[model samples]
Every structure is written in structure tokens, then in C-alpha cells.
Target: MNKRFIKGTMAALVSMLATNAFAATEVTVYTAFESDILAKYKNAFEKTNPDIEINWVRDSTGIMTAKLLAEKNNPQAEVVWGLAGSSMALLKEEGILKTYSPKGLDELRSELNDPQSTQAWYGNDAFFNAICFNEIVAQQQNLPKPTSWEDLTKPVYKGHIAMPNPASSGTGYMQVSAWLQSMGDNQGWAYMKDLHSNIAHYTHSGSKPCVQAGMGEVAIGISMASRGAKLKTQGAPLDVITPAGIGWESEAVGIVKVSDAAKRVVDWSISKEANELYVEMYPVVGHKDVEASVANFPNVQQKMAKMDFARMGNERADVLKTWSDKFDGKSEAK
Candidate 1:
């Protein structure tokens, strides 16, 4: 080839590369998914949809919810994946979510998707509150194994328990909501008041309490089943206890009312492939056909409380306010 022709070809190639890069859609996704699994989900999605890229903004559920609501006027997120259903419901009420039913919406369990005709969100997987009792730690502290939520308040367990702060953790909120629904509002608050006297301190993250328990920092952790299961598998000397009638929250996805890429992400999020990926980590997935049984994690559906999640979503602010007023000062120093 002539030197002039070679130079022209190189220039054209560079310009084409730039154009393609610009043409590839970049969707900003906000999520409260565990940091360890975020990259895996992103990679899995990108592998299938090579033309689109996901930019993840990850945090604890409460922080993610607050951030989305705060950015309501000028929304930045194109989609929300792995947020708690309660938070998604609140966002829907605030008019922050756009309705777009994913392709496999009918294939999902009826309770897993939004019931509205104009669906704003759909669940991917679920996680629920559980007690992580470290056998070694409990033995060391001369503590008995706690079998129920009521057992945690016993004097023998005083100052040997750690729990997440509801103000910050989705797991924490689930626990609180479950108690209220299961035990009635007045009794639940009374129970918490007694439990508060025995608590060592409340951590900000849901999984932290279980991690602390695994390391023998506390005898018991009021945390999630999946975290406790993972810790036990790693030889944490932990017992992952799924107490009966405990509250659980689905890790859900919703489209923000912005970006052309939002619908695409939402569609993929509820696909069979995505459901397969989600089940690898969570016991319950949106799709009824996808069944998961993580070792050391109990069958959550059998134990989950009959909660009115919509009511929980509506009452979230008030419940958190009541909890904060009662226990915020007792939280461990950050």
C-alpha cells in the first residue's frame, strides 16, 4: 500500500474506534449488593450484552435508598439492582421509578414481582434476618444457645449480643419489621426495649454483626442467613439459625425514570440467565423454576413471617425514627 493510503487507513480506524466507544451505552446502576459479588454480576451481564457497560454505585441498602430519593429531582442512576424491596416500594411511591415489566415477568413467582398493572420493580433474590450463634464464643462466655428472638433478651445473654442498626442496614429493618408484624406493634416495641438492655452494640452494616460473631467478637449476631452460612463454611464455628416467623426482604431491581439503557438492564435482570446467577448466592430467586439450597442456609420461605411488605414500606420512615430514638446512641463507634 502507498504510505499516504496507510496513514489514511490508520486515521479512519482511530475515528471508528472512538465512534464505537461513544456508541456503546453506559448505564449507571445503583445497588446494595455485597461488594464481593458486584463484579461477578456486572461481568455476567456485560458478557451477554457486550454493547452496554454497567457502572455500579454500591452501598448498604439504607444509604442507596437515601441517595436515590435525594437525587429525585435530577436522577443519576439508570437502574437499581439488588436493593431491598421495601426501599424499591418507597422509591415507587416517590415517583422515582419507571414502570417496565421484564420479559419473563409471568415466569416469576406472583409474590416476587410488583402486583400493580404498571410494574415498577421486580425481585431477583431474597435474604432474611437470622441469628448467628458462635458455638465457641457462646461456650467461652458461658452462654446458652438462643432458640428464638425472645431468648436473646434473657439476662444470661446480656452484653454478649451484637445486631445491626436499622437506621443503616436493610437486614436490621427486616428484623424490626418482622418483630412488629409477628408480635404486634405494642409487644414488639416492648420486646426490643428489653433486648436493647442485652445488646453489646449495633453495627452499621448487616453482615458485620455476623462477621464479628464468627470471629468470636460477640456470642451472637442478629444478621442475615447467607452471611452466617458463608462464615460457617469457612470454619467460623458458627450456627446459622433461621428463627421461625423472621422477616425477609427480596433483593430487587427497578428502572430509574431516565436513560435509554434502563429498560435493557431491567429486562436482563429478570431473565432466566440472571436468575441462575442470583440463585448461586441466594436460596430464593424470583423465578419459581430456579431453586437454590445454599449449605448452612435454611429454607427461608418456610420460616418467613407473613408480612405486609407494602405496609412496611409505607411505615419505614416512622419505624426507623422510632428505632433511632430508642437505640441510635447505643451503636458502636464507627
Candidate 2:
């Protein structure tokens, strides 16, 4: 609570926070961004804030969310960057996140602002569920193309599908959350039970299923639309199918208020330059004027569910538990 401490004591995340002889302040940042982009983000941010350096602690969305909740009393991270908005909402609900309005907040889409704590969190981009159908594998196996969520449950697709485990992935959680919201809880649970029968295995990483599908390891992969689109462009004989309507979540940022440097990072996270970086991988960004685009990615602006991130955050624990109990048997070796 006291902010009088020097470099190493402010945010509780600085293993190397320094004010000694021009040493840069190290801001501890927890993130779930894909591994390839971490260095780019760090380099760009440090270039802009030469006095402050980022100390990144990265993990999957579910792991990051659990870690933040676990460390709420003595938070190890000063900021959370590029995690699911629903996960950010959970942190906000637990009061693990601190409030700070960024510099370019007005330039971002109003709808991307968190309904629960606008000052605490804002989205950078959206990622939604998609079906990765391997044409080569399907042709070999005589599988019919699946066009909807229900189509995934047919006997023909049994033991041929791969998906992420919700307990370990935000994409998995959003898919489950979306089904419950769209199909109603009773039907949703029933739907999962049926779908579980067709699943060959569940992956730990949200990106893995599509990668596996692209490699012909699995005929179908329940994975993110962004990953699917990228794989398709790379000449993977895969169909990146965005279902008629599907679940989506924004990768968002929030502050932990351990130091002024943390606030600076949050500010940079929402800037126009940041949006430009985000849009290179994600087709939709918080910045309204950025005109986000992804090559070979389908138009999904109208297909996203009216997600209630607050509700998803609030219900996360219960939902994960139920999902694990019902479906963890099929998960790949962690």
C-alpha cells in the first residue's frame, strides 16, 4: 500500500527494478500472448520507454488467470497484458486489478471497453472458435463436412476430433461459455456430453488442435479462427471454417497498480501503435480507426455472440470444475 519504496519494492514484481545509476525500471508483466510476439512487444515498448523495461511472465490464459487469483494478496505481476477479457473481468471482480484510464481510450471502440471496470481493462483484439477441417484426412476417412456445433457430435466424426481443454485454455472456456449461453445450460451440458464422445483428445494449448489438424494428425480441430486462417494461408490443406455463429473473446490488458511504471505500460498497450501491432495477428482491435485485418481470415464481425464477460468471469470456477469432471478424461498428456 505504501509507495515510498525505491526501485525493487514498488510493484512486488521487480526482481531487477532499478533506479541505481540509470538502470531501467523493470515492470513485471504477466501475459498470454503467443510466444513469437512477446519479444516484439517487449522491444517496441522498451524502445518507447527507454527508462522502463518489461519483465514478462507468460502462460496460457487459464494458468495466468489462476496465477493472478492465487497471488491476489501478494500479486507477483504489476500488469496483465494480452489475456482474455473474461479473465481480466474475473481479476477485476476479485479486485486483483487496479484502475487506470489509458491515453488513447477515446480512440478505441466503445464496445471493446469492459462493462465491469472500464478503467481497469480494455480489449486489443478478438479470437473466436473455428472448425479446422483437414480435407486430405477427411477424404481418406470418408467424413462428411461439419457445418455447425451439433454436426460435430455425429458418429461419423467420433474419435476424429481434437479440441482444447477448458481448464487450461481461454479458447476452451469461451467455447463452453458460449454454448451454455447460446444453447441454455441444460442443453449445453448435454451437448458437451455428446460432443465428448466424438473427441479423440483435448489439447492443452488452444493453438495445438489446429496445428495437429493442419498436420493431418486429426481430421478436425476445434481451434481459434485466427490460427486456422494463418494455417490455411501457409498452404495447409485445411479448411478454416468459422461456424455460422460462434464464441469469441478479446485479448485484453489491465493494471495491478504496483507502480507508476505499470500504468505507463498499460497506456502503451492501448495506443494506436499498439493497435497496429495487434492487428497484424488479430483481425479486430480495440482501436476503431486502426482498420484491423488478417489475410485469408473470414468476416466474423456479425457472427460473434453477445458475450457477457462479467458473467463468464463470475462463473469461471464452477464452469471449469464441471467441464473437467465431465471431459478431462480425453485430454492429452499435460
Provide the overall lDDT of each model, using Cα atoms, as 2-decimal numbers: 0.87, 0.87
Candidate with best TM-score: 1
Model 2 TM-score is 0.83
Instruction: Tell me the tens digit of each residue's lDDT in model 1 across 1-334.
Output: 7999999999999999999877768899999988999888889988988889999999877788899999999999989999888888888888999888677788887676666777888999877888999999788778988888888999999999999998777788889999999999999999999999999999989899999999999889999888999999888999888779787888889989555577878888988889998898888899888987677876678788876666778998899999999988889777
- The TM-score between candidate 1 and the true structure equals 0.85
Clashes of each: 0, 0
Candidates in order: C-alpha RMSD to true structure: 3.5, 7.4
Model 2 lDDT tens row, 136-204: 999999998988899999999999999999887777888899899888899999999999999999998
Candidate 1 lDDT (Cα, 0 to 1): 0.87
